[model samples]
Target: MRFALLGVAVLAVSLFVMSGQMGVPSDLPFPVQVAIAGAAGVAAWHARRSWWPLAALGAVTYAWLVVWPPLLVASYFAGRTLGRGRGLAAYLGACLAVQGVSALVGEARDGPQEIMTASLGNALFMALGTIGLPLAVGLWTRARKETAEERARRLEREQIMRAEQVRAQERARIAREMHDIVAHRVSLIVLHAGALEVRTTDEETAETAALIGGIGREALSNLRDVLGVLRTPRPDSPAPDLSPHPALDDPDLSPRPALGDPDATYRPQPTLGDLDRLLDQSRALGITVTRHDEGDPRPVEETVERTAYRVIQEALTNVHKHAGDAHTDVLLRFADGELEVEIRNQRPHGHPENLLGTDLSGAGWGLVGLRERVELLGGTLRTSTEESGGFLVSARIPA
Candidate 1:
């Protein structure tokens, strides 16, 4: 508003001086003309922000004839920029005030008779030309600028939202990969260490194996704690239980356990042959899972078997989380050079409600981790909602 006022004042003063040089309104002193222009600028500036200021300015402009048309023009634009209702109000108020002031001044200077003789139509013509058109143009420009700015701001917000989503997805992917790879290996180490401690007969060897087992258990505990921090679980997810282990939690034990003899060896890990055992365990837990082996069962590379097993394991895990009692079907198809595994679950019925129910819906990166694992083994996995309102997960890997 200040800038607009300043610009108008400068322009008006320049024009007035130029007109004075041409002997027009030359009777007014130079200083008086500058003051009139300044007042006009100030009034115009106020007009843009509020109707009251613009109205007051309009009255003052009417009393001061030297700043007539510019004041009127400024008020019109101010009104248009303000919007139709307010702008029109300002424009009309200024116009009427100008005419009223003009009439009173004319009566005082030229007498009531001469003032009444002047054509009222001519005043109306000047007001329409000077104020009406300028106000309309200003309003149009203001509306256009506002619309463009709104669209740009909306797009900027959407772009920022998309970037945030991508960052969240990447964070989840990293967390899942760490859990799948590191947790599996660490679990194996813990298992082997425990077996060695139980089997060793010599006191020294047994003590060393016991130490290794203690370290592995502590490591596993620490790993779970880290996962708790990384994976922000949903409301329904069970809180991780990090209860102290009786053997590993001895107060006399060193704060950090020393590395013992790393002689514990893991047994050949379960491959696809052990899937029947997995299904049996699920069945024991009251989950109905039917398995089908298509084509002649044949041996495959260790990596392929391991990946296939993990895929089914993850699928089963997800089912247990969402709907533990749901019936599921597992299919293992062996082709010439490829092995395909499919696990589908009927929509969840319901689980027995309890405070300590088997709800292990931890970090929701199970599927994401499984996909990455499968892809790493040159396999493709697809999961989708079934038309029958169930769920389907399928994976194919080069055998």
Candidate 2:
């Protein structure tokens, strides 16, 4: 819209100037003068696209009638579009040639004395004021615009680099804290569990101790992988080695996957297929848990399945903490284009205060982490207490 207005303004000014020049009594008819003025206006309006044609027309008309608007407009646009190279040199050469031709035409009409005195002086002054000034302003404007754009791009790249540096520093700090606190505590738990497994005589007690120790060892392995990642220089590097390190090694612990194996670095994530084992683990801990399926089962993306599994795991963990031995139901409904997971638990049998023992209490970030995970996959998680005093946790994820 602005460009259209600019074009119209240029055309209007060109017509006004041309009309003033042609207003003097001449041999041309009034209609012919109007037609010539309209043509000059149109040429000035389109000077941006091809300024040379307008320049040529303006030179011819100026030599004959001493009109200058179209020539000034063409010179401004030529400076804007043409760089300081051969193109600009060629245009200046043409302008000089037009001045020479105009001088010769003036000498033919008036005498050589008039051409040498008043005519030459007026022509030089007009060329400097109309052409040189506008051309210089156009070139300066273009240079200023190019410099501002380049500075803006440089600032954007610098901002990105600073952001990455802050993120790397934060990751390194977190890795150090986790290694100092959580890793040390987990290592001690694994050692204690290993001692219990070796010293126990009863078969069932030994088996339970063995299971506890195995779970602790696996937790330490996963923690080590996470720390390795946080310590790496680049985020896109290959996964860290999963083989047991000397600091975390135990003779009684079961063997882990071999080092240097192609699949060792990329461990399989838990999915819906592992839901049965998860339920069994809760049942073994004396929790009454049951699972039900609705609608037809369909395969979904691995990320969706992983998030669903985590939702159920975190919900069950909450049940153990807040509803001791409460009846829990796990529902999986596979519907068109989506999968829904719901875990509902009955109210605790005893006082809630008694059920929430210090050992079973958590840091309370499980649900928050689960919500982040679900939302990242374009899903929603909801948790609420029912009127009957039961608690419900549900997640809906796109397949």
The number of the candidate with the highest lDDT is 2
- Report the number of the highest-TM-score candidate: 2
Model 1 Cα lDDT, one tens digit per residue, 1-399 = 565855586447535642544112424666766666666566555555554554455455444442344545565566445656765676577566666666666555553322331348745654565566666677788788889999999999999989978876775676567567765666667667768878888877777666656656655555554554445334235434322443333332313323461211122455787788778766655689999889999889988898888888888877766766788999999988899999998867753332112345563577789889889988899988775657788999988
Task: Provide TM-scores for the models.
Answer: 0.45, 0.77
Residue-level error in angstroms, candidate 2, position 384: 2.9
Candidate 1 is scored at a TM of: 0.45
Residue-wise C-alpha lDDT for candidate 2, range 1-399, written one tens digit per residue:
553455566556655554554221234566775666566766765664676777777777666655566677778887788889998898888777777776776676665323432376776877786678878887988888889999999999999999989988898889878877777777788788778888989888877777777777777767766776687655457655423444454434424458676555346778999999889888876789999999999889999999999999999988877787888999999988889999998877875533323464453589899999999988899988886678889999999
